[model samples]
Target: MTLSFKSLGLSEACVAHLDHLDFKTPTPIQAQAIPHLLSGRDVVGRAQTGTGKTAAFALPMLEQIDVGDRSLQALVLTPTRELALQVYQAIQLFNTDRRLQILTVYGGQSVERQVSRLRKGVQMVVGTPGRVLDLLGRGDLKLDKLNWLVLDEADEMLNMGFIKDVETILNQAPAERQTAFFSATMDPVIRELSAKFLRSPVTVTIDQPKAAPNRINQVAYLIPKGWTKARALQPILELEDPESALIFVRTRRAAAELTRQLQAAGHSVDEYHGDLSQSQRERLLLRFRQRQVRWVVATDIAARGLHVEDLTHVINYDLPDSLESYVHRIGRTGRAGKEGIAISLVHPLDKRKLRDIERHIRQKLEWGTIPTRAEIEARYIDKLKSRVQEALTGERMASFLPIVSQLSEEFEPRMIAAAALQMAYDQTRPSWMRVEPEATDDDRRPSRPSGGGSRTPQTKSRRPKINRVSEPSSPSRS
Candidate 1:
C-alpha cells in the first residue's frame, strides 16, 4: 500500500509544504519512525548516511515544536560542521512556510556570528558538539527550555572523539525532554550512551537496499602498475560521456595537479581541497553542479559532505584511505535512483586494502580490463562518425550542403568520409600524445614487494584474459 504523510497524522499545512517540496512519499526510516515520534516517543534510528534519516527526525520534531514560544524547543546535535550545515538546510527547506526559525552553530566559523543568530531567537539549533558546549558554557545558548533533543550521526561523533562533549550537552538538556539518537553503526559507546540517556526509546532500523543505490554502476579497473593510469581512465570517461564527474585523489596537492593536467588536456575541470576558502569551495561545487565544469578533482577531506544529487560519475584517481572512505566516496554517485558510475584506478600497493574492503562489504570487487590504444581510437572514431551523422540530420545544414556538393564534385563519398575522419582525429587526439601498449598479462594481477629484489605473488594467478574487457556487462554480473 502507498502511504502518505497525511495518513501519518501531519497537519494540512505540513502536507502542503511537502507537496511544494515535491516530497510525495516517505522513505522507510521516515515511515516507521514519524508516527511514533509525532506521538512523542523517544526514538533510536539506525541507517547509513544517505538514507533520508534527516527528514525522518526533522519532520516530527518540527511538527511537535511550539512556534508560539520563542525559546529553543528542539536541539539537534551533529558530529561535524558539514553535517550540521546539511541538517540546517533541510530544516530551512522543510519549514519554509511554518515560520520555524532554525540556526546552526559549529566550529570553523566565528563565535560572534553564532551568538548573533542565537540572540535572534531560533527554535531549533543544529550544532556540532564542541561549539554547542562552548556556547552553553558562555551562557549564550540555553537548553533548559528545550523540549526535544536529537543526536544525529552518533557513530561519527564517537569516531571523532566527541562522546564526552555529547554527554555534557545531554546533561544540560531538561531531564524530561524527549530524546532521539540516530547512527549508521552502533558501537558499545553509542549503546551505553543510549542506555544512560534515552528513556526506553523506540528502536528503528532500515535494512540497506538489496542493490547499491539506484543507477550507480560500480566497476574496478585492474591496470598495470608501471603504466599511466590516466591513459586507462581516458577511454572510460569518453565511453560514459558523463556530464559532470568527480575524480577522487588522496592528497590536496594531487587534487590540484590532476585538475590542472586534465584541464590542459581539453577537459573543463576544477580542483577542490581544504585549503580553499569556504566561498571558493562553495563556488567550485556550485559550478560543477550547474555543469559549468565537466569534472571536479578532489581529495577525501574536500569531497566530504558534498550533497550534489545530479553527479553522474565518481572516479577514484587513487584508492581511498580506508574501506569506509571508499564506500562514502562512491556513495556520492548513484543517489536518488539515478544511474551513476564509479570507477577506481587500482595500483599494486592497493591489493591488501582492496581485499580488506571486499571482506568488509562481504562482496568481491569486480575486475575489468584496461582499454587498449587501438580500442580507444576505434571508439573515438565511432563517436566522431555519430556526430557527423547528427549534423547531417539536424536543422542547421543549409550552408554546409553547398560546400558538401562542391566537395562531392571533386571527391568520391569514401574520400569525403576520410577527410571528415581525419579532421575528427586531428581535433580529438590528446595534444601531447603517446601510443603505449596495454601492460603485459603477468603485470595485470597485483603483487607484493619481497625482502629481496624479487617480487612475491600475493594471490594465485588466475586464467589470463584473452581480450581486454573495458566495462562491466551488468551491475550484479560484475
Candidate 2:
C-alpha cells in the first residue's frame, strides 16, 4: 500500500516541509513507526543508516511538542554530538514555520551557554548521553515536564559505553511520557534495555542491505612508503574532481590538518570534528548542504548523522579500525539506487583491515592507481573541452562575442580562439601544476619505486579506466 507522511499521521506543516524537500513516500521505517508514535505509543524501531528513521521519530515528536508552553516538552538522546546536532536540525526543519524554541546540548561547548538557553524556555532538547546526564544532575534540566522522549541510535550509545548515562537520563524522565528507541542493531543489550525501560513499545525492524559493492565502486589506493598520503591525494582529487566529497580521518587533529592542507591547495573544503563548537558546526553543515562547500574533512564520530544527496566520492585518508565502521562510512554515498565511489588510502600494514572489509562486503575492491601528472592534465583538458562545447551551445556565450569579434579584426579567427582557450586554461590551472618541469615516465605515476632497476619504456602498464565513486573520506596518519 502507498503511504505518504500525511497518511502516516504527520502534521500538515510537517507534510508540507517534507513535500518541499521532494519526499513523495515514507520509507519503510517511517511507514511502520510513525503511526504508532503518533498514537502516543512507545516505539522500538530497528533500522540501518539511511533508512529515513530520523523523520520516522522526529515528525511524531514534533507533533506532540508543546511549543506554546516554552518548557522543555521533548528530549532526544543521541550517542554523539554530531547525531545530536543532526537530530536537532531535523526537528528545526520540521518546525521551521512554527519557529519553536529547541536547543541542542552536548559536550565541548560551554555548559553555561546551554544553561542560558535552557533558562530561556526551550520546548525541545537533543543531546548526547554524557552531556545530557550532566545537565540533568545539575537540576537545571527538568524532565518533570518532558512529554516525549527519543533515543536515537540506541545501539551505538551502548557501543560507546553511554548506556549507563542513557539509563540515568531515561530514569529521570516522566514515566507517563511517550518514548521511542531507534537503533541500527537490536542486540541483546539494547533489547534488554528497552524491555526494562519502555512501556509496551511497538517494535519495527528494517532488514540490513546485502553486500555494498553492488552500488558503490569500492577502490583502494596504496600509498607508497616513501610518499605521504596527503601528497598523493592531490593528484587523486585532480583526477576525480568530485562535485561533493567527505574525506574521513581518524582523529580531530588529522581532520583539521588535512582540511588546512586541502584549503591551502585552493580546494573548496573545510574541517568538521568534535573540537568545533555547536554554532560553528551548524554553519559549516548549512554551507555544505547548500553546496557552497564542495568537500569536508570529518571524523567518523563527528559525521554520524551527516547526509547529503548525490555525493560524488567518499575518500578514506585513513582506513577504519573496524569492518562495520568501514562499511558504514562508505554507505553514506551510493544511496537510493544511485552509484557512488569509495576511495581508501592504505599502507602495507592495512592489508588485514582491507581484506576483512572485502570479506565482509563479499567482493574484491579495485586497486586505484594514484593518478600521474599526465593523467590529471588530460582530465583537465577533457573537462575544459566539454565546458567549451557547453558554452558554444549556451546563450551565455552571447556575452563574450564582442571580445571575440574585436580580436578577429586583428588576428585569424582560429588564432583568436586559441589565445582565448589558452587564457581560460592558464587562468583555471594552478600555477604549481603548470610551472613544474616535465617529469620522467616513472615520476609521472605516483607509485612505489620499481625494485631499483631500470625497465624498458614499452613495459608500462595500461592506466585504469576512470570510474568515479563518492562518499565521506577518512584521513591518513601522515
Candidate 3:
C-alpha cells in the first residue's frame, strides 16, 4: 500500500494544497521526517538532495508557524543563495493559505531591501548563513519568537566553510526552538555538529538500496594516457547524443574553459558559476529549462538547488573530490522514477577516488570505452535509417514522389533515393563530424592556455600568476 500526505496526519489544508500541486504520495524522507517535525522534535534527516527533503522539513515547519503574531517564527539556513531562493519559492507554493509572510535573504541582492522587508514582520525567513548572520548582527532580525530552526544542506555548508557562521546563528537562536539538521552524508563533523545542536533528535536516514537504482545506468570511461578529458568528452557526447545534460566540473575556471571549448566546437552548451550575475543565472536557467541549451557546465556550488525535468544524462567531466558530491551530482537525474544515465570520465590517477565512490554508492560503475569513429558513424546511420523508415510511412512521402519520379527518368530509382537520403543525412550530421580538424601538439595541453598570438623574443606570453586569496571565515551568502 502506498502512503499519502493525508494518511501521514497532515492538516487537511496542507493536504489539499499538496494535492493541488499534484503531490499525492510522500517520498521516503517526507514520510519519515515530517511526523517528528510536526510533533516538535528535533530531527536529523540523512538523504540525497533530490529526495524531497526540502518539503520534508518545510511543510511541517509551515504548519507550526504562528501566522497571527507575524514574528519570525521559523528560520531556514542554506549554504548558497541559489538554494536559499529555491527553498523560499518552494515554501511559497505550500503557503496556499496565505497565512504566513515569508522572506528570502541572501547576498548579491540589495541588503536595504531585505532590511525593509524584515521590518515589515515576516513570519518565516529563509537565507544563506552570511546574510542571516549579518542581519542578526545589525539587530534587524530577531529570533526571540522563533519556534523552529532548520539547517538545510549542513554538509554543503561545512564544505563551503560556513560551519562557524552556522554555529554562531544556531547559538543565537532561542535554545528552546525545535532544530532540524539535514544532510546528504553523515561525516564525523556533521555528526558532531548535530550532537552539539539538536536536543536528543530523532535520527531518520533513508539509505539508497545496496544495488544502484536500476533507473540510473552508471558508466565511466577511463581517459587514455595521452588524451585530455576535453578530447575524450567529445566522442562520448557524440555517441550518447544526450537531449539534455548537466556537466559537472571541479572549479569555476574549468567550467568556463569547458563551456568555451564545447561552444567553439559548435555544441549548444553554457557555463554556470559564481561569476555570473543573478539575472544571468536566471536567464541561463530559463534557457536550460526550455531546452535552448543542450548541456550546462557548472561547479558544485553553482549547481546546487537546480532542478530540471526529464534530464537525460549527468556527465561528471571532472569527478568530485568526495563520494557525497558524486552522489549528489548524479542524483540530479534519475528522479521521480524516471530512468536516466550518469557518465563519468575518469583518469588513471583518479581510479582510487572512483573506487571510493563505488563503495559509497554500493555499486561498481560499469567500465565504458570511448566509442570508436566507426561506431559513432554506425549510430548516426542507424538514426538516419529510422528517419527514412518514418518518412516512407508519412503523408509527406507522396508529395515528394513526383519529384523523385522525374529524377528517376534520368537516373536509376535506387540512385535517386540514395541521393535524397544522403542529402538528409548530411543536413542532420553533427558539426564535429562534418569538420574533423587535424590534431596538434597544442591540443594535448591539459590546462587552459593563454590567448593565441605570435610572440617576439622580448614579448613572450607567460602564464598569469594566480594569487590565492584566503577567504574570510565569515560565510558568503552568494
Candidate 4:
C-alpha cells in the first residue's frame, strides 16, 4: 500500500508541511514506526542512513510539540557536527509552517553563541555529545523540560567514545520523557543501549535483505601505494562521466589536495572539509544539487548525511576504516533505485580492512579493470560531445551562432565543436595540480583512527534517563 502521513495520524498542518517538502509517501522506517512513536512510546529504530529515518522521528516529534511552549522540548544528540546540522535542517523543514525555533550546539564553535540562542528560548536543541554535555555541566542549557530525546547514530556515538557522555546527559533528563534511539547497525553495544534505556520501545529495522544497495555496482582497484592515485582517479572519473561525483577521502587535508588536483586537471570540481564554514559547506552542496558543479571531494566528517539524488558515482579516494564507514560511503550513490557505481582505490595496506568489510558483509566485491589512457581519452571525447549537445540545445546557443557560422565557413561543424570543447576543458582544470606518486602512510592517514575505527562492545553500570521540562511560551513569536 502507498502510505500517506494523514493515514499515519499526523495533523493537517504537519501533513501540509510534508507535502510542501515533496514527501508523498512513507519510507519503510516511517511506515512501521510513526504510529507507535506518535503514541509517545520509546523506539529503537535500527535503520541505515539514506532510509529517511530522520523524518520518521522528526515528524512525530514535531506533532507532539506544543507550539505555545518555549522550553527545551526535544533534544537530539548526534555523533558528529555534520549530523547535528542535518537533523537541525530536518527539524527546520518540519517546523517551517509553525515557525518553531530550533538551535544547534556543537564543538569547533563559540559556546557563547549557543548560550545566547538558548537565552532567546528555543524549543529544540540539536547538538553533538561533547557540546551538549558542556552545556549541561555549565548550566547554560537545561534538559528538565525536554519532551523527546533522540540519540541519533547511536552506534557511532559509542564508537566515538561518547557513550558515557550520552548516558550522563540522558541521566539528567526525567525518566518519563519519550525517547528514540536510531542506529544503522544493531551492534551489541547498541542493543544493550536499547535494552537499558527504552521503556518496552517499539523496534523498527528497515535494512533490506541486501547489505549493499542493488543499484550500485561496487568494484575495487588494486593500486600500489607509490602509484599515482590522482592519475588513477582521472581515468575512472572519465569513464564514468558522472554528472556529479563524490570522492571520499580520509582527512580534511587529503580532500582539499585532491579537490585542487582534480580542478587543476580541467574538471569542474570543488572540495569540502571540516575546515570550511557551515555557510560555505551549504553553498557547495546547493551547487552540487543544482548540477552547477561536477565533483565534490570530501571527508566522511564533512559529507555525513549529504543527500544528492543525482549523484552517479562515489569514489573511495581513501579506504574507509571500517565496514560501517564503507557501507555509508557507498550508500551515498545507488540511491532510490538509480544506477550508480562505487570504486575504491585500494592499496596493499587497505587489504585487511577491505577483507574485514567483505567478511562482515558476507560478500566478495567484484574486481574491475582500470581505464587505460586511450580509453580515458575516448570517454573524454564522448563527454565533450554530450556537453556540446547540451549547450547547443539550450536557448543560450543563439548568442554563439555568429561565431559558429564564422568558424564553419572554414572548418566542419564538428571541428568547431571540438575547438569549443577543448577551450572549455582547458579553462576548468585545477591550478596547484601535481601528478606525484600515490600517497604514503605518513601523508594520507591520520595519527589515530579519525573516529573511523570499530570497537568491542562494553557495558555500563546504569541507564541514564532524559528529563522533560515544559515552560510556557510568550504569546508573540520571535
Backbone collision count in every prediction? 2, 24, 0, 18
- Where model 3 places Cα greater than 4 Å from the true spot, the runs are 389-402, 405-409, 435-478
Choose 1 or 4, whichever is better by lDDT. 4
Residue-wise C-alpha lDDT for candidate 1, range 138-247, written one tens digit per residue:
99999878999999988778877899999999988899989999987788999999999999899999876432454566667755655556656665565556787888
Global CA lDDT computed for model 3: 0.83
TM-score of each: 0.82, 0.82, 0.86, 0.78
Q: Model 2, residue 100: displacement in angstroms?
A: 5.0
Model 3 reaches what TM-score against the true structure?
0.86
Q: How would you encode candidate 2's per-residue C-alpha lDDT over 15-40 as one tens digit per residue?
A: 88889988889888999999998898
Mind giving the per-residue lDDT tens digits that candidate 3 earns over 1-478? 8899988779999999899999989999999999898888999999878889989999998787878887899999999888888899888888865768899998888899999999999999999999999999999999998899999998899889999999999999888989999998787989999999989999999987852576888888777666668777887787799999999887787787778878776789999988899778878989999999989998888999887889999999888877778888898888888999999988889888988988888887777766655556778999999988998899988888889888888999999888888888888876656655455444331321122221111122221111111211212322
Scored by Cα lDDT, where does model 4 land?
A: 0.76
Candidate number with greatest lDDT: 3
Q: How well does candidate 4 match the true structure in TM-score terms? A: 0.78
lDDT of 2: 0.80
Residue-wise lDDT of candidate 4 within 13-97, one digit each (tens)?
A: 8888789888888888998889999988899998878888888889888887876888889999998877888888877877754
* Clashing residue pairs, backbone N/CA/C < 3 A, model 3: none
